[model samples]
Target: MAEFVEVAKTSEIPAGGAKVVEVNGKKIAIFHVDGEFYAIDDTCSHEDASLAAGTVDGTEVMCPLHGARFDLKTGKNLSLPAVFPVQSYALKIENGVIYIQV
Candidate 1:
């Protein structure tokens, strides 16, 4: 089973925003959407764009480089220019702390 690692505090991510955290040498993107948290790989499938620097709207995250849209909740690629789906990690919030299963 994957172990949960404390990535960041709940207050670190603003509303409709995302933050990148390195856990076990892996880059993970933590997103805050509508008061909920979602974790996914920071690297974009297409090119080398950072999803953490992209725009966050609800559960969707758009790539800042080529406007590739991805669903943060399911790691699904919604638009073109990005054929491969980004990896997604499990997220848990406890006592105002954000934990990710890595």
Candidate 2:
């Protein structure tokens, strides 16, 4: 069974901010938006770019490289140049800490 790994604290990521963490040796991007948290693969599916550095709009992120957009909730590619979807992780919060299932 997959286990949930502690990634970050709620305070570590402010609203409309993002952080990159390695869980089970894979880089995952954690986002805090509108008082909620979301997690997805840190790498962009379109290019060799970091999604953590992308722009967050609502619940989606626009890739900084080629402008590929991805839905933070489902990791679905929302724009062009990205033919595949990045992996989305299950995230849960307890107290003030964030956990990502891996």
Candidate 3:
């Protein structure tokens, strides 16, 4: 089983926003959408853009570099230019802390 590590506090990510956190030297993007939290790899599959710096719209995040869109909830590439989907990590919430299983 993968280990769950506390990545950030719930308050750290504002609603309808995303945050980039380093876990075990790996960059992970955490998003807060519609009162739910989703975790995914920070790097854009199409380029070197950081998804955490991208715009968060509902459950989808747009790549800031080439405008590739990804579904934060399922790690699905929803637009062109990104043929591969970014990796997504399991997430759990405990008391107000967000934990990610990597």
Top TM-score model: 2
Clashing pairs in 1: none
lDDT of 3 by residue, 1-102 (tens): 689999999999999888999998989999998899999999999989899999888789999988999999778899989999998998999999999998
C-alpha RMSD by candidate, in order: 0.9, 0.6, 0.9
Q: Residue 74 CA error for candidate 2 (Å)?
A: 0.2
Residue-level lDDT tens digits of model 2 in 4-102: 989999999989999999977889999999998999999999878999999999999999999999999999998899999999999899999999899
lDDT of each: 0.90, 0.94, 0.92
| C-alpha positional error of residue 94 in candidate 3 after TM-score superposition, expressed in Å | 0.6
Error of 2 at 83 (Å): 0.5
| Candidate 2 Cα errors over 4 Å, as ranges | none
What digit string (tens of lDDT, one per residue) describes model 1 on residues 3-94?
Answer: 99888999999988889999878788999888889998899999998999998777899999999999998889999899999889888889
C-alpha displacement of 102 in model 2, angstroms? 0.5
TM-score: model 2 vs. ground truth: 0.97
Backbone clashes, candidate 1? 0
For candidate 2, the lDDT comes to 0.94
Query: Which stretches of candidate 3 lie above 4 Å from their native place?
Result: none
